[model samples]
Target chain A: MTLVKVYVNYKKSILNPEAQAIHSALNRLGYSNISDVKLGKYFEITVDDDSKDIDSEINEICDKLLANVNMESYRYEIVEGANA
Target chain B: MTLVKVYVNYKKSILNPEAQAIHSALNRLGYSNISDVKLGKYFEITVDDDSKDIDSEINEICDKLLANVNMESYRYEIVEGANA
Candidate 1:
């Protein structure tokens, strides 16, 4: 088995409503200095073995589907593992 | 300033199409053993210095905005920083 970790986020230049909401929530919770907020996500994927050159294949996936080139940024790391 | 990191992910029980695409990419790239894939994202936010009890404030923000209790999960870490 192969383990992959992916990180995706909105580009810095874009406005994020979700982040803004988070900022207000922080304000209500009592933090006065929290002028801004940005939200992000993380994921782990486990793949079964059917191919040979896994890393390159995964990078292709990132380039094509896992990431949106227009507004989001993403990076992935691979960790070889013992599983199905 | 306060540095906040949020990690949001789909529950294990959920189906992730992004992850599925990544899996195929890995297969194409040469990792034959990779049968499945899951995608996730990460974000870093800087909050200005204005509140006391920053940790609790950030936690509340997480509960309200950064995380989705129904399908996605989130966790945050605060790093005291040398900036506004």
Candidate 2:
């Protein structure tokens, strides 16, 4: 099996209220050193080894289901032996 | 500035309904090669340069706010020059 790690996050132009809230909360909790915070989605997908063109398949999956594509962008990395 | 990437996920013993839902959706979408899916939260935190002992500070933050230590576990990587 091949393990793919995907990260989906809001575009740079978008204002993430959740991240802002977290930053404020961190400040309230006395972590004043935190300058910024960004919240995103992470997915670990395991695919069968028989598949061909894993890169295209992963991109298609991300585009179709994982990421919104309009306001969010995604990136992925494939690990050859990530059965664990 | 330092960029810390934090990944928070449910422990192996915990049941992840969201991941299961996604897996089902993928199967419905005809991605039969997919074997498993795991979903989690990803955070990008930028910290001020003046902070001393960044490792300990990040650990404290993760323990106190970023993750629920009981059901979820978190790991982080510090990227020194990640201003972009």
Candidate 3:
């Protein structure tokens, strides 16, 4: 099987209130050295070894489901032997 | 500045309904080649370069605020030159 690690995050132009809240909370907790905090979703997908055109398939999946293309962007890496 | 990438995920024994839902949705979408799916949180924290003991500080931050240690586990990597 192939283990695909996908990271979906907001675009730079978008304002992420949750991330801002986390940053404020961190500062309140005394982590003043932290300059910024950004939050996103991560996915570990296990695909059958027989998949042809895996890259295209992954892109399609990300566009169709994993990420909000209008406000978010995504990137993925394929790990050949990692456990799902 | 240092960019810390933190990945927080449920422990293997924990039930992840969101992941299950995504998996089932994929199957319904005719992507049967996908065997499994796991979902998690990803954080990008940018910290000032002046901080000493970054590793310890990061661990403390994760334990205190970023993760629910009882149900989730987290790992982080320090990327030296990545833009926050």
Candidate of highest lDDT: 3
Show what share of the native A-B interface contacts model 2 retains.
0.90
The best-first sequence of candidates by lDDT reads 3, 2, 1
Off by over 4 Å in 2: none
Instruction: Give the alpha carbon lDDT tens digit for every residue of B39-81 in model 2.
Output: 9999999998888899999999999988999999999999997
Candidate 1 per-residue lDDT, tens place, B19-41, comes to: 68656766686656656665555
Q: Rate the local accuracy (lDDT) of all candidates.
A: 0.67, 0.94, 0.96
In candidate 3, what are the lDDT values of residues B1-57, reduced to their tens digit?
999999999999999999999999999999999999999999999999888899999
lDDT, model 2: 0.94
**Residue B18 accuracy (lDDT) in model 2:** 95
Indicate the worst ten consecutive residues by lDDT in candidate 1 chain B: B34-43
Candidate 2: the clashing residue pairs are none
Per-residue C-alpha lDDT of model 1 across residues A1-84, encoded as one tens digit per residue: 677777767788878897687567667866566666665556576766665766776666666766676887777777777562
Query: Residue B65's C-alpha lDDT in candidate 2?
Result: 89
Per-residue lDDT of candidate 2, residues A1-84 (tens digit): 999999999999999999999999999999898999999999999999989899999999999999999999999999997765
- Let me know the DockQ for model 2: 0.91
